[model samples]
Target: MTDASTVIAKPVSQNRAIWQQFRTHRGALFGLIVLGVLAVVVLIGPYLWIPEKLSVAEAIKLKNQGPSWRFPLGTDQLGRDMLARMMLAGRISLAVGLVAMTIAILFGTLIGVLAGYFRRLDGPLMRLTDMFLALPLIPLLLVLVMLFRDRVASIIGPEMGAFALIVFAIGITSWMSTARIVRGEVLTLKEREYVLAARSIGARPHRIILRHILPNVISPVMVSATLEVANAIITESVLSFLGLGFPPDFPTWGRLLFDGLQYMQVYPERVIWPGLAISLTVLSVNYIGDGLRDALDPRIRGR
Candidate 1:
């Protein structure tokens, strides 16, 4: 169905140009590499280095040990290996960020593009966005968790159920800003010369949006996506800190930090590893987002 030669000749060059553009920003490149490596480590490290000592009994005697050869980041109050727990924690934290971002992006982009492209839906959608913006996010999340946590847990097993509930709550709560950003971009893009050209050729509104509008507005959408991931991660951590998210036995970075707070004076490593992980992850994502914004922007790509 497709001509290999045509793609080989044309698409390769286009991709090369994009890659070159992306590579121009040193910080973005570094962030991309770090993020890629961190993702791999978190996703794979758990399997290769089993955290068999994750259970309570193993840590009972080994508790509160500092960093050493046996336990790289040292043992926690329960003596669980910090290194192993961090890997598994990274898995859950990253998963929450990614899944939540996907839901947010899909809903935000849809609402934004529609509201921006059509006048009929604009007022209602924007009003809804404004209403959400006005609400207190933390309180709203607490209410949702209280109301549906058990119900959701009953529908799905606790692990996945908590995952879905947290992701859904964060995604629903966080889409307003993205929607606004996308709507603003769409409003500008719809007036562009190419969009007008598409209209002159009798293109359907949906087709024009899909083929012309969305592609052009992707830069901002991507920027929003990165920020959304960071936000979701932090929000989940907060939920865990409040004991409303994943179960207590789970090793989320936030939970780890919360657990280690009281022991900070004695065994600081309990807080250090997870805290550093959260800080580094958020910082890397922010840098990557910054790099992406410049690389993906036509105006700045080559500069």
Candidate 2:
């Protein structure tokens, strides 16, 4: 017979249990490792391998050279060190994705929670969401950029202004889907016993949402956040490819792709590097989202 002390199982905290479930997903584990490694490289690699500080003549002399011991990724047409540029570009790309996703998640959650909790407001708020959904995303982005890019650039200087506009554009356009998902979840949650119990106790709407609704809905929101990051990165890349993003001098992954397009025939690696980076980053984020969805769901967490 087992001793009572030995038979008794210690309880696991919610966070610890969730982490255990998350770790069980091999794809998620791999994605997390890859993303962490990339983040470290982008953060520290630039200092070790400085990019494009050579004099104009010296830079010109190094143009179009293949990778060597000095330049591990080869020099671009303008003779900037490819490795350094890549690190800098990764920083910007990741920043854009994270910041934009934050904005989208915040706004979407607000809209979703409000609409889901208040039956009186649901029709109008959902209709508004529908209106946004009906709009063509790419065309709207182009128009927003064309109309505001020059004015914003003049006010804040080109690089910062462009970053702000792109982030804003992607954030607003991407929130609709998240809103719909969250709203659906909230609608189901609000009718649950705990939410109804909070209502009976004279808790305010805001308090009820904060204490009960948001916590319950976080799983889906996290999944949406991951997808938003991937989408924002791709959108930024497209804008840069079209020459509508950051100025030519400020390197982003997308801009790097555009610059390398001309040299593709002679030095295909120029395009391959950035393209591969974008694809792998997006793929990793998608895997992470898939894992989070499974780990966060009450029904699936243990199974």
Candidate 3:
């Protein structure tokens, strides 16, 4: 007896309400705008300046130069244009964040959903997650990178090889938190009336999980994904700073930060450029995640 328009209108109203809630959070709104601008610049800016590719080697005459019309950002110790370095670094940094988060989310969600939905799998899987959680992250990362970096580099080329190893290291390390969160959410959702109803009808476990459980559990997964992006970026930065990440010639924001530290006393702009990019990118992602969390939760959205 319900009208089609009524169903459509309800969803439209909810979407509008969520948008309004997001917009009202001033920090979140600013973050959305800033992130949008950053995405545009990093994705499109490189192509616009065909003469100044981000990967080009340094110009010796421009070495250690300050901000000028020719090089608005400045030149680094190696004479590579700082602006170009930044653009290219952003590409690598952003890619690492996204890809690593995706891998973590996949592993975490699979483990979480299985453990939470099926009682037989809960103890063992959760114990496995805990074991991973207990390991010291930095030491494990160092060991893994040293062990596999050469082999991976040879297979995938140096830049991509390092990239794969770093992403895998991060993905493996970072998924524990997501698994815990998703498991808890699934435990709660699997007990809800709709799930009970689905079970009562003799629905298969897989069908119930796919049709009823996953949709309800997706909000937490999305929030976790946003936070994971920031975590991945910071992890990559740490590796690069330690000289264990990208190839020497291949610049990443973290590598730039490491290189600039020695000259911090002299041209502070060297540090400033890469440092600002990392900070802004991470901060913006965090704020956007905050807004998304509030927007997605009906209880929080109204308040």
Candidate 4:
């Protein structure tokens, strides 16, 4: 008679063990700390205080103002507070990155798991995934943006429309890598003794996948997700800078870059701030992803 308490405790104990192992990786620990700080800043900084509404006339005064006591980062061409706008923009950029990556990860994991577990589906599914992989993402995204501009604006309103488009574009394109990674992991895991045991016990396919396979495959998925966030963010910035991103009324980091590019010769700092923000955020995310990969893989740890 298996004790229910013991059965529940086993999973909790296993989770704790994994966490303990993860903590031992120094780079991952550092990355976590940095990411935590950045996340807090992005989430809380905008809500602490509100910026005064500047009429188009009043907004003209601070245009291209360099770093000073009044404005820490400086004012943009529109006279909007650079620091305030940067922080505000961070919210949108980060949100899109996380949400888009989450969509990709969820869909990719589902496809990968199904394909890997059912051998008959593997060839066709993988080839389809390969097709997406083969297509050029940036050009496709540009075409989609142009083709669906009016429809997207009507659906989500101007403020959120561009963000949503960026998310969809990134999510659809980014899943290929995740699917490939998850497929490989699932293939190896599905053949393990525990999976065979579960099958022998009359566990349904869904139950076996959920209970036995998902746990083992989740580590790589997590690493992929972290890295994809950075990719998505960069993609959003590129789109925005090309004047295809969020409308002027609602600014994002990429939009700032676009606005700043005009004044780069007169006030280079306008371009610098947003560029730095994007670079730093992406760099930090990549570092964290690297850490997660190292921490999650025993082979890397052993090496």
Candidate 5:
């Protein structure tokens, strides 16, 4: 029987090993820190500044004002606070990306696990996932957004229409990669000795999957989910810029960039700010994802 001291020491040792692995990748470590800082600023910084309310009219000021001590990033054409809007908008954009990816991961894992574990279902399940993969994602999103604009708005309200659209669009298309990855992992894991041992021990199929299979396979799924956040955010921005996303009243980084596009020649900063935001956010996420992939995989660590 394990003593209390032994139990406590085991987790501590495991955590130290994980940290050692994570610390080995300098770029990933930096990316992790950047992501953590950005997430905190986006989630908590805005509330501290404007706890009273979020008013469009009140937030607006001198239009096209260049970066000043007061405005920092400067005001938009609508005279809204650029910095404030950025902070606020980050919350929505990041939230949409995360939530959408979560939905995709959950759904994809379910389908992949079932298809891999059940030999009979593999062909049909994979075929359907392939169909989605075969289609052009952007054009399909465009058509879906146009067709379901009103219905989507009705369900989630006008304020959240763009966010909802981004979530749904990304969720649907993003799952294909996850499904494929999970399927591959599950197929390999299902063949392992532990799985056969679990089966021989009178473990039900569900118990075998939950207790033995998912644990070994979930690392790749986590990395895929992180990378998907960047993809979903970029896709949302693209849709919003095309005017197929949120209304003018709702300000996301994409819509801000769209509004600034007309003034690109006159006021390039307008375009620059939002574009930079999108680029940095996506880059940071991707870097972190790469880091996680290396950290979790022992083969990569050796290199």
Candidate 6:
């Protein structure tokens, strides 16, 4: 009989190995550190910085000001503090990315598992996935926002309504790729000996899927989630830049970009700040995902 310590030790060793593999990827390690730093700064920044409660007349005095000890990042065209705005925008953008990815992963996993596990569901669900894949993503998102934004804004307050609409639109639309990946993984996993053994024993489908299939498929799902976060951020940015995402007064990285566009020639830093934030964030997430894909796969990890 196996000892309890042996079982525990084996898992610990395996996790250590996986972490070692992840660390070997320099890009991934860098991304992890950068992301951590960004998260911490954004979370604590507003409390520390304390944006001034300025009236329009007072705000006008600070408008178009360059960086100084007073405002490290400088002031925007409207005299808003760039550093404070950056921290706030980072919080919103990161929140959107994480929330949207969660929605996509949950929905995609459900559809993919059902389609892959049950023979009856395979064809129809796959076809539905295909139909969604064929549609133009930007156009569909635009249509969704146009159709529902006003009604949603009315039901909830405008800010929250826009947030929900943007997150849902991005999440629902982005799941097709994840669904396809998960379906393929599930198809292969269902044919494995353990799964066949579970089926032969008359285990319920739900039980088998929960106990066996889902755990096996988690690696791919985790990798997909990272990519989904980047996709969601970029999508939200696009919508905001187009002036359809959030209310004008509500600042997001995308909104900052939109506002800075007109000032691009004169105050180029206005455009640069938000643009760099978006680009670096997306790139970091993609690198992290790439590293995770390698670290999570046994074959690659072993190498």
Best by lDDT: 6
Q: Model 3, residue 138: what's the lDDT?
A: 85
Q: Report the C-alpha lDDT of model 1 over 1-303, residue by residue, as the tens digit.
A: 898766755344655666777788787788788888889989989888775535567668788888888887887777778888889999999999999999999999999999999989999999999999999999999999889989988998788888999999999999999999999999999999999999999999999999999988787899999999999999999988788888867778988888888999987777888888888888888888887777676677543
What TM-score, computed on C-alpha atoms, does each candidate reach? 0.90, 0.96, 0.92, 0.89, 0.89, 0.95
- Which residue pairs clash in candidate 3? none
Give the per-residue lDDT digits (tens) of candidate 3, residues 13-109. 7778789888887878988898889888888977874435344344665678999987888888867778877888889899999999999999999
lDDT of 2: 0.91
The deviation in Å at residue 41 for candidate 5 is 2.0
- Give the C-alpha miss distance for residue 64 in model 6, angstroms: 1.6
| Superposed Cα deviation of residue 139, candidate 3 (Å) | 1.5
lDDT of 4 by residue, 1-303 (tens): 998766754334544555666677676677677777777887898887466788898889767778888788888877888888888888888898999999899989988998899999999999999999899888898898888877888987867776777788889888988999999999999889999999998999999999999999989999999989999999889888999878876777899999888788988888888898888788878877877776677675552
lDDT per model vs. reference: 0.87, 0.91, 0.88, 0.84, 0.83, 0.92
lDDT of 2 by residue, 166-220 (tens): 9999998889888889899999999999989999989999899999999988889
Residue 70 lDDT (model 6) = 86
- The predicted structure with the larger TM-score, 3 or 4, is 3
Give the local distance difference test score of model 6: 0.92
| Candidate 3 regions with alpha-carbon error over 4 angstroms | 1-12, 50-58
Clashes of each: 0, 0, 0, 0, 1, 0
Candidates, ranked, lDDT: 6, 2, 3, 1, 4, 5
Model 6 earns a TM-score of: 0.95
Q: RMSD of model 6, in Å?
A: 3.4
Question: Candidate 5, which ten residues in sequence have the lowest lDDT sum?
Answer: 8-17
What lDDT is obtained when candidate 3 is compared to the true structure?
0.88
Kindly report which residue pairs in candidate 2 clash with one another: none
Error of 5 at 37 (Å): 2.1
For candidate 2, what's the RMSD?
A: 1.6
